[model samples]
Target: MNALRTLISLVFAALLIAVGAFPTGAAAQIGAKSEVHTEQVQARLLAWAPQGVATGAAASGAPGTVWVGLQITHQPGWHTYWKNSGDSGLPTELQWTLPPGVMAGDIAWPLPKKIPIANLANYGYEGTVLLPVPLIVTPEYKPGPLTEAMDIGLKASWLVCRQECIPQEGEFALRLPLRSSTALDGGAFEAALKSQPAELTGAQQVQVAGERLQVRISGLPEAVRGQALELFPETPNILLTAATRGDAPGPRSWTQRWDGAVWTADVPLSPDRADSPADLPLVLVTDDGQGWRADATVSGAWPAPAPVAAMSPALEAALAANAARGAAGGGPAVAPPAAPAAVPAGTFTWALLGALLGGMLLNLMPCVFPVLAIKVLGFARHGDDRRAHRISGLAYSAGVVLSFVALGALMLALRAAGEQLGWGFQLQSPLVVALLGTLFAVLGLNLAGVFEFGQFLPSGVATLQARHPVVDAGLSGVLAVAVASPCTAPFMGASLGLAVGLPAAQALALFAALGLGMALPYLAASWLPAVARALPKPGAWMDVFKKFMAFPMFGTAVWLLWVLGQQSGIDGAGALLALWVALALLLWALGLAGRTRWLIASVALAFGAFLAQAIGPAVLRGAEPAALQAQAAPAAGERWQPWSPERVQALLGQGQPVFVDFTAAWCVTCQYNKKTTLANGEVLAAMDAARVQTLRADWTRRDPVISAELQRLGRSGVPVYVLLAPGQAPKVFSEVLSAADVKDALAALKS
Candidate 1:
């Protein structure tokens, strides 16, 4: 199945290139437009003429100006920053490579809206927006031919943000018609021009008094006289943009008042202010979205710049590299830092503590208990040997902590490179799921006494374990995390979410804390005198107990197989089970003596290999991702439909409440809720009474959309239940949910 998915992806990529469906930087000859589609944004270079201007003109005749704009359309819930991105974010940048005779003007940025993220506020645009630029053709330019086109090349980069920030870039080349003015997308261009903030023609004043930065405007448009207004500063880091409390929409962090003809606003100045410009440029917008720009004269001395937290060198380097990647061959210009959500003070410490507690609680979860049980049994065998027990425990803790840090680092690096991944990301890969299932199945067989290490191992090799008992304990810790981390036990989700937004050093510390928490209990059992004394003495019944433990191992294997079915469909799961059977048979045969054993093992190995190579591709070809199928054909009698941002918005627009279940097949906690509280009869009745829409965002497979939504809600993993009511903030449930939780949310919806 893994091979099949990889092959399909490769084939599609090749097909896109062969058919010219892939974006290219080559000059577009057919139309005066060059477009590129990044993962979350669709950007294009458009050429158009002013209204009433004739498109027909001699190629070598007159010098005229045409309008060219970089038009960007963001996916729902995503946005790109404006020139002055308040709080944090990088503005869109364009690097032009034009003909000697042609020149381009600065981007005519349209008025931006305040985008609040947690406590921080950013200035940006959502939906579709065009940044128009003027292209001037001077008399110094000589036309080569009557039919020749003006070649324009552009290299552009932008930082797009939803819950997280992604740095993206594209190269575009447009061949504008020299013989005639190109007026493509003229309506869009006209609308964009209208959206631009009109320059103020009235007197404006700016004065600083203590902590307040006051602005006064003498003349105001009658249309916006008594309405509430939003102020957008053109200068960065001059005013405080972080909200005082939550993300509830309201006026700015300061206050504003209207004195009939004159408008007055008093906003707090940022303590982190490092610049004091003579003229403070600002844009004021009314409730009706009309805007005017003003450059008010400075009237007072600026305060001292506050001491700020120093950014880690690694973070600084990464930002530098990201900026370099976009500006590679385009000159010395660099992009502004990609400002993700800032980590508030004490966030790291809180998250670390949460991660540790969550890790300790993980031992009680069904997915992890079996592994920990085996460790406990081993502790009993060690009995009174405190030194050996302590050594083994330390080794195991080291393994667990190191493994967690490694995984966290990888996740962070991948996210930095623009992969929308979260916790339990490994389980998203079919290959990893298959491998873990096989490992658990083999362990089950071994525990059940179907095969013994002594039968197959050379004498000296088998004794290696006795000489290095800690090696076995350490490996067990690695195995436990592989199967258990996907559970996302209580208190873990928020910590993991916070970790992603933190600096690398702090994030890794949180992961290590979680591992330490998970290992603390076992370490205490091994080292503490009273706890060690309480352990059961080894007896002849130990063999029987070991075999009994095999059942739990088998159960885990079965669960993994079921998860595989959810990802690769039934055919993939069936193939995997067949392979497991063959593996068991081969292991048994290897334990036997003589040529009969060799013959059986040889045949088993060959058969298993053949099944993997031949049947795997066929299974892949016949089956689609189970998540897609489940959405198309929901389970019998289920009221839930597949989730999408568009659907949620549409439902909310119609005055309906929404309940979204962010889940995945591998997430055991999510399944528990699904079969329990979410399915409770009383809960369903309440939901029906309230007409609450239920949408399931299945993360059985790698889904960027669901990932983004989870990030937006400040969660890094699944089992997230969000109840969104119109005109209210979304209410996110705890990791463990209950019938009462759903009922109460429904009750609130009704209220």
Candidate 2:
């Protein structure tokens, strides 16, 4: 009886330990048999299957391949990335622990969707997706029954994203009976295989030039050709996926076309990576969720795309029409060009030369004259010190080069961000114009001996620092660039246009060349002692010249005021004049104030504040109305209608020739052309005879439509002459127009 009791207690203890070791739920699951593993992760439902691994001949017969699949169902709005995740995101990863004698192939990626998030575009999949993997089973593998199944494990990790992203991972196991016969049907696997990109039916060709890739695909369906398509490169770091867009040929973008049966695309490549043109792997996807895989070969050398002269007339017309439509909608109209062909080594050399010539000519423009005069005076002062003169020259050149580079970078950055800004974009703002006007007025007053700041300074220090070569030279460079904004010289158009589309380093080099050109004359004069000596000696004559220089500053101020008046109406101009008066009074009071300087300064500040408060709103409000009024009225008997992109398109569509004068009131070059060439009686008569529909795009005010149109024409500033003949690409003329040039263009139109 005692022995029986002891055995019972031992059995009870053993049972208790066993129950503690395995909880009821775990124990039940361990005993449960299943062929597949499924789990719900953070943002996705995942399932893994060793679907085709079967017992008998299927496993023990001659070595064969088995298909395994991981099916992931994303939560609504959540997605997993493709092999190439554009802009940002990570692709899914799978690691397997297969039985010995089994080898796994790469995941067979299905077609992915282009997922746009905010301003960025990503390639990914939404909803349910199955990733298929093929496994090779060796003949050495043993067959198994349902009770003794083969174990296959998978470690899967992926990123799922909505507005935010979540990383998820799971370890999954599958138990499958080894079989002698193949499994003919796999539900999810079959579907996944169907979704795989089909191989292209015909030959594909790829051409690489500089940072661009062009692909020619033959034998595509018409429906697929007409629809918007996206290209996915299997090779990483070769192309910019985010830069992809619908095909429109230009200078620095991706464009695609379907020429009836064959499809062609010019794609922008990543500048940071070098890729061979041979055997490019690509997948082309349509908007309707169909995709075709194509392997392209490098058949021959791909020449860089030629300029507009080589473009087809029909294509040019179509691009122009698109611009017109965008203008009509009051949106950005300039379509980015096709990925620019690699510029030849000689091309940059020519561009640099053009930039140099243009910069040298820029010194002659009316707007730059005042600053140039100031610089001449500075040179005269530094004439006695050779070292100082050289130093000043170098400093001036540095300033000019740095400023150009900075401005070019800003323009490029803005363009990249989709802002339709161009050269002299700063002048388009009335506030900038007003500020510059004020500065010019103050400088003019100082030069004219009105309340000199030097008078208040101690005599010794004032005399000692009267002329700072470095400061004067640097400031002169700044002033030169500021005034030069309103002028675009000959050769400047092509050079600047090319620079804007080139790679960043090349573009910057072009800007540097321009600056070097502008500063060359001054630099040469300073460095050559003979040239410096050729300048007149410093004397009372310089004082007279200095005072005379004030006149140009006043003139510039007057011009800026006029531009301001055009931007803002008469009332706004009056407000600016009032502000100027306040400034003058403040300066006068400061000069006269002896003991009560603080009190006078306070009063002046209050008066300025009062004026700004009273007039600021009116000035801001008047700008739009002024622009509208200008648009409504054509200059009296001007024989030119106000220009709109819509009007240009209509006239072109009707087979009538049109001449566009892109002008601004502040642009001295424009004013000169208007007075000299455009106003010539013979030119007017010729146009009249040709029945040319004259259109004036007045850019005196901030006009987005005109701005976009200028950019579309590859110009950044005013005084652009565009002569459009019926059914032909428009001819862009020089900034400084001549009667003969206008006549010749018109005669060509007639012919």
lDDT of 1 by residue, 480-517 (tens): 78887788989998888778877788889889998999
Clashing residue pair totals per candidate (backbone < 3 A): 0, 16
Candidate 1 has its poorest 10 consecutive residues by lDDT at 624-633
What TM-score, over all chains together, does every model reach?
0.43, 0.41
Report the error of model 2 at residue 440, Å: 1.0
lDDT by residue (tens digit), candidate 2, 1-751: 0112122223422332222232333222232221221232232222333344543235457666677767777667667788877655678898888777677899899998877643346777887888888777776665544435556777777766554344455555655545333343366777888889889766788887655777888866666767767788887556765564654744336888877777888887654344454688889888776888988886455444333222234333434554565456543334343343447799899999999999888888888788778767877776678898888788788777777788788887877765666677778777667767777777776677676655554665454434454655665676678768767899988988888778888888888888888888888877888877878989998889878988998899889888777565455566667767776666666677576766786697578656665564333332232111113233335567777766777788788889998875434456557767888999999999998889887654456567667868866667789999765668998887878988988888767
Using lDDT as the measure, which candidate wins?
Answer: 1
Q: Pick the candidate with the highest TM-score.
A: 1
